[model samples]
Target: MSAAPFGFFGKIIEIDLTGGDARVLPLDTALVADYLGGRGLATRLFYDAVDPQCDPLGPDNVVVIAASPLIGTTAPTSARGHMVFKSPLTGVIGTSNSGGGWGHTFKSAGYDALVIKGKADSPVWIDIAPGKIEVLPAHHLWGQDIHATNDELTSGFEAGSRPRALCIGPGGENLVLYAVVGNDKNRVYGRCGGGAVWGSKNLKAIRVQGKEKIQIHDKERYQSGYDQALYLLRQAPVTKRLMRELGTAGLVELINVINMLPHRNFQDCTHRPEDLERMSGETIAKTILEKAAGCYLCPIGCQRHTRIDGDDGSTQRGEGPEYETVVLMGPDCGIYDLAAITTANYRCNELGIDTISFGGTVACAMELGERGLLGAEKEGGLDLRFGAAAELEKLAVDTAHRRGAGALLAEGSYRLAERCGRADLSMTVKKLELPAYDPRASFTQALGYMTSPSGACHLRGGYAVSLAFFGGTKEIPRFSLLQSPIAIRNMQNTGILQDSLGVCRFTGYAFGSDPWSRMLTGVTGMDFSVFRLEEIENRVASLERLFNVEAGATAADDALPPRFAETPIVVAGEEKMVSEQAQERMRRDYYSVRGWDSEGRPTRALLEDLAIAPRAGRAS
Candidate 1:
């Protein structure tokens, strides 16, 4: 009802796909003040609009995409978009972020967020611009891969007004549990099952183009933070040269150096030095890398644009085979062929599957086959051996299509292992497959994974390994029990702020919340001091915990698989594993620091203190 704030349009587009109806709603300024934006704001809106216990793929499931106030600004890496939904894979809160031009363009379309509810009778795509919105029939777009869908939807627009599309490929249409949403051709909301949610609703894509400008209230203050951030980013070795030179896969050797690299479904962290080099960032850069790219306004330029020569002498061009894709699909499965991993990476992107989850699931299947758990008949004659490089790309195609052995792989590692009667073999926390990092080496990282709202996400789970490798002054002891709890808590909160602000996680390597505080205050003309930002981070984290708890999550759910405890990996000449005693103690300490009760539920008093309304029958 009132005018929007300086940094925001204070508008939300609500779409009811069942009826093909859309309405523009005024976003409450007070809510924006409390939640900030992006992940924080989307989470608040989603928690209130949908039932926590609703089936994830059912019509009742809701999807919320919000852009931060900084999105349309000049801040580095300010083009990220945050999406939240109930995860079909993990069956809990599904939160994911992506870096690309889509977020900035969506914000520039004169709205702050988009919310979709109910299910469409057929496939459709939403077209948005200033003062115009329509749900168009997308029957022709339904079965297309991500690149085709993107090109088809974004075509016909004028040069400067070409729309940016966020869409799902065949993986999503088939409802592969870990399907990802692709934007800017390759950038993806890669974690959780957001693409599956889009599929369930019969939504193909949402294309947006606009030229709306954001208002900056204090240019001097904003410039001050901007200058400091750039200076610090230039000074940090990770952001300054390492990312620009080698990209994220550069971490392969470094992570291996710390004994944190996973191998053979996390059987061990051992790898031959040559094998490591074969899949490292240096290999990608030297062998297949066509060029390095960056997202909107990003300086780190971690995006890897590469090409690989096919056996038939055909050269295929695509992006990535980043650290996670390389290790998880390579040595973790006992295959270190860069060409194989890169080819698989391209297939996963085109099909809209999550490389991390797919790799982990394949490794699980390999272990199952090695132990005689996989039925020979059901495998369709595909070898499920640990080093089956031939099956790597084939499995990706099958999984996306839910065909043959991939039907089992499509269910993710947890379900595949459980169906095979060996749930313990699944290396996951909360059913979401763990990232490339082996938690046995870092106690703080292990704690972060345990407490992360959306299952075992390194980004959502604090990215504690970053501190281990590049924290500089902010780094903490990786194995300290006393420091692990609060340390991980702070790291998770920092992640919350970055996601909420729509910034890059790599930016944290350069500076903390102070610079961002100044920029936010300058843009919104509001008091966003470090203390207030911390309060907002705590509130958002507590709110997410509330949603999970109401969805039947418990302290028990915040745990790693049995392998993390029983199987110890040697680190620094000593066997290391997260013991049960250590896990319980750290979990308890984390809850205390987060102001949650012992059972991992937020107390009603604490919720009230943070201004989060308690759901009915919760926070008792």
Candidate 2:
């Protein structure tokens, strides 16, 4: 295969823990050309290596580290990475994208991606530098929390660098399926059980550092394109305000406006109207935000660094109570104390647990408590109620440590609910709990939550961006009852493309301005224009669908939780609803647009057009 200049490292690193072997493999340039990078590359890799029947937490499972052309670039918000794996929490494929210095470091470390497989018999940590790789024993670090692990590693190396580290905490050590790998303290590749996979492998952490300079094919042109893109981004009202005011937490109010905020395990979509403004992003920004931080070379620093006033007259500084964390652990779980929520956010960071799953799981427990399914005995003698801030923190720590009832909650809401014989109490898709948004309030996101490779999540394709960015109507399409299927497909395809590029979707606001496309052309000197890139994006989306099909996912898998279809939100004294027929029709139109059959399987012709060859077990 020819070298992929288009900002691609054109190399894949495979680590075999069982054999203690590592090798640099060539990335398929054809695949790179067709699928782009990040999630696209990851899906293709999973198609080649993993079987649908493989246990998600087993040694055979593959965890993909993917970076794209824009990664490590001067392009605004371009430093991001995706960690893709089959979810232990959910039986489905999952991809969790995160922002940090890690992607940039990995890209500059001379590899485009890392595919790790096979379990190690003993704990180990891999330190990958620009040209060197060392697999070190991690026996002593086996039980440390994520923050302490990062701290010790940084101090031990004496590199005078606080290099980004992705480490599993006690949650992962105890095999919690919802365990997460945290880096940049607060940022996480959060949704999937990648942490459990790491834990099972006896891998403590992956510490990476790279001093290698990023090389662009046409440095001058790249700089020019980047400058122009930054200008447009600065002018975008939402993007600008996001930078100046709330960072990404700005979405809190927007979700509130549509009454989509997942409150009390989604038994209610809106919080009490009086508390709306107090719990809004605007409030968080005004009250707690102390500063903003950024990663690597990005100019738009959307990460809010805040200090929350804890009880006992002390304070704790953390990354954020971003919209999702604020809603999921805050109002959703019934904790309105911003300080308490921030403390919980910090605790999750320190413990390396995903806030979404951690908080949602607690919300599920609270709902069960309210329904009389769980009381003192079931909760180990603590009153688990939504909005009990003290209990929220207790549960947070307990879940991380896997103590008492925390053991059950740590397994994720779906499994926990099943164990308690109240499956309806878990607000989730597949097995992962839904993020902050209520699907009944935003049908596009409902589709996003349901069909995301991961379980219920918002990152797959944020439909709120549809209303906020695209000239859509006042409300985010709440019922995928009509055009949502097609619109969602478009968003998913573009989302994959954006992820492949390893650039922030925030740059989409600057689309057509040629900033990112120019960076692509300049970095690798690949002759790509924005229009052609869109075509590649389309092919990548189709490729992902094909891979999922080969892995046994069918049209039946593309479905919302039954509650979403059966229970309509009572808003403005009217029923806001989505019907089965509407979803089916929308999905049908979506399939047609993507050149797929009624079963939502990609057609042979479509595969050929997209240069995706069918493997032996792939059904026609």
Candidate 3:
């Protein structure tokens, strides 16, 4: 095959940790064109390399680090990076995305993705600088937290260098299933056991730095599109001002206004006005937020830098308790103390655990306790009660150590609740805990969650909650069930395009596929039209569904937990629940659109049409 195109170096670095061998392989540019990049290409690569029957934590499970065509480009929010692996937590194909300097830095090292297979015989880490790869022993660094690990890896390097690292903490060392692989000590491959996978491999971190120049086919046109995207970024209400000024935490109040903010284990979606204010972005801004940070190529500084005093009187400094963390730890767990939430968020980051999973698990345990399930001696004299900010604080640390009740909590809400005989109280889908958005309140978002490839997730399916909470092409009525299926499918396709291109979702608010098409065509000289990108999205979505099916998932696994489908989260006089009838309608329409069978498996004809049937086994 000929060398890859301008925007893509078309290289994949495959490391076999079990045998301590590394190979630099040529990536298929045709596959790049078909899948686009990032999540799409990564999933395709994973399908080829993974065994559907392999345990997610076993040596057979494959992990791919996906660097998109847009990485290191001037494309707005193009700093995002992605990983595709089988999740130990959800027991499905795992796709995790994050933004920081890692993608750009690694791309600069002149490789497209890192495909790691097998396990290291012992704790190890890799340092990849331009033209060099060193596998070093990490036994001494094994137990360190994310921050400490980052510090250890970069200690000898000069200040303000371009090296980026992804590391796990004690959570991973001990195999917390919800462990995270943190990039830059803050932004993380935060969902679906990315860290647990790393732990399983006895791999601690991957640090890279490079200065290789990235080429663009049409620099002038690429610049123009980049400029247009930047202009639109400035014009967006959420991106330009709100996100830049208040960080993602700014969204806490907006979600609260819509009454979609989950509180007290989602038993109530709405909170008292005062309680809402207490956890509001404005409150965080005025109280603990020290600054707003941004990712590479992103003008919107929605990342937060926060600090607060701990009970021990020591200062705790950390990057966000982002909107999800704030609510999941605060309102969802019924802890309204901003400082407490911030502190807990700090500890979670250091421990390399997912805040969403960590806090949501605690919230579920709290509800179990409230329902008299804890029976007093709930492991280590635990006071698993809602509104206990102190316990919430302790929970993060204990969960990291997997101490007592923490061991049960570490299994995630689905298994934990099953053992507790309170599975009805667990708010999750396909085993992954839900995000801050309540499905009952955001009807379309709920539909997206049900069929999301990575289980009950917000981003992987689509962040349709955005269209309803804020303004969009037109106002979307939250209650209109009929508008949801098609709308969610379209949004999910758009999401795939965004993730495939390695751009931040925040910038997705400002522009559409037209500008993205411009970036793709101008840089790589591909015939990347808006229509073609949509097909690529459909192709990617179907491929992921097929992977899940090959792993034994069916329509029965596609429904929401009983909490959202059965119990109504009361709000103002309205008995609100995601009607089961509406959900069935949405699923049928979604499957029809994608040519999927009732079993949620992709049809042979549809696979052939997408031209992914052959590789529905190696691609970009």
Candidate 4:
């Protein structure tokens, strides 16, 4: 027991589920200085803890959860937790982030990170507190839905101070490739099959509670940055008013306006104006929204707590159907019934499923059915048709339980389409399903998805749509090849910095890295200036690339599906498509800008220059 860093506990807990043994490892000051925390720290730890080619769902896979130094401070939306592991779905690095009390509480429990490896012989959950850790049996909690498990695990604590719980439901237990891990009942680590990884290890939940406070080295510097951040957030329309009024679903109408909205598995971005209105954010706000909420210490308040009428004539209350969920499940599936999408959204959350992937998978299935690909017998009598709103709710349940056709969908869209003998039909990149945005409308976005380490993720990529609309002076031409590669690289780096800092992505709409660098330096008494932060961002990006390369990724994997190049979507009255030539050029330029080789591997010299040592043998 030694004194920790000013802003960190400087401790990591490594738990072996096989023997139920836990050991405390001292966090290195150099590692903290290089990687900061959250995604970067977790990735560095995970890379050393598991073989690059290890089975993602096997005992050898490592799950690293880390908190940034900003978590226990007054930083806006600083409660995010970053989870890194090899993805069961994509077979690349899986980096997922979540917002809730869990990360904040986990840091409060006197540790900066928790690394779980090996597997339990039976169902279990981990309880963590200051100076205490336990691996407890959770057989009774097995097969329970997310809400129930959360309630059952978090009960009996003092009011307002209940320990936070992160758990999966039947989806994870069945090893659905796109299952999520839920926290705060609604907030989730909602991508890259983290839930399936947890399920494979027989982990049911992780409960944490503590009250340790982080020390700020310079209160004056911290307050200065905090004030500037708040002022800018107030000045930004998206953060100040739009999010609170309409939630992320507010983007429904806006994205449609930009021709970025996908319809019917991205056959085209065209949609009937009336249909868009039916499921738009305005409709949700006026129809079913119960209230707006925010994550721990967040001011944007973009969370949508709403109620929808069930087919059984009863009202059900739950969280979103966010913009991605709404479009992917509604318009992408050609289903405009808001109530049905909302109901299905609730089911996905309860079942611990990633709604974005599930929706994309369903849309792919529908496209296959339309093209006479999904055989009637293979469908198990399910509709599997676009605009089949009646079947959306049932699909959620079936997918989670691996029942009927869900067994195929449980493998995700790539496997499902490949099973149907049409791998090209799957709207995916690197096996992870695409989000709601159609990449054809924006070359920068298309490049982002092509180069994103996590595959087709807007957040993990660049969220380039934000630049098109709300990037203020930072906005660039969406279709400029000369500008897109560098622009997207910078955007992705900004995202890396934000994720590593445990901050929200939406904050980019208001401000950039300066305020965050100030706040981080103020709290940690470290020189996290903009230049140093950029270096760290490049280091983390290259490290992630190194992991993917060792895991068998190549330049070919950095590509969009053929549909983007084969078909055209009209943007601003001009037909647009990301041609193979364009993709290759952008990909090559992106690799060059990232200091990677043309084959998309981090060059030895570049790695050495970043001071990133080559991966060593697995850690004990």
- Alpha-carbon RMSD, candidate 1: 1.7
TM-score, candidate number 2: 0.93
lDDT of 3 by residue, 195-295 (tens): 88989999999999887767889877778788889899889898888986777777787777777899888887767778778767788888888888798
Model 3 C-alpha lDDT versus the unseen true structure: 0.84
Q: How far is candidate 3 from the true structure (C-alpha RMSD, Å)?
A: 2.0
> What is the C-alpha local distance difference test score of candidate 2?
0.75
Which candidate, 1 or 3, would have the higher lDDT against the true structure? 1
**Candidates in order: C-alpha RMSD to true structure:** 1.7, 2.8, 2.0, 1.7
Q: Write candidate 4's Cα lDDT for 427-511 as tens digits.
A: 9999999988899988999999998899999988887877554457766888888889998998899999999999999999899
Candidate 4 has which clashing residue pairs, if any? none
Clashes of each: 0, 3, 0, 0
lDDT of 1: 0.91
Which parts of model 2 are misplaced by more than 4 Å?
4-6, 156-162, 375-383, 468-480, 615-620
Total colliding residue pairs, candidate 4:
0
Count clashing residue pairs in model 1: 0
- TM-score of every candidate: 0.98, 0.93, 0.96, 0.98
Report residue 219 deviation for candidate 1 (angstroms).
Answer: 1.4
Q: Which pairs clash (backbone N, Cα, C closer than 3 Å) in model 1?
A: none
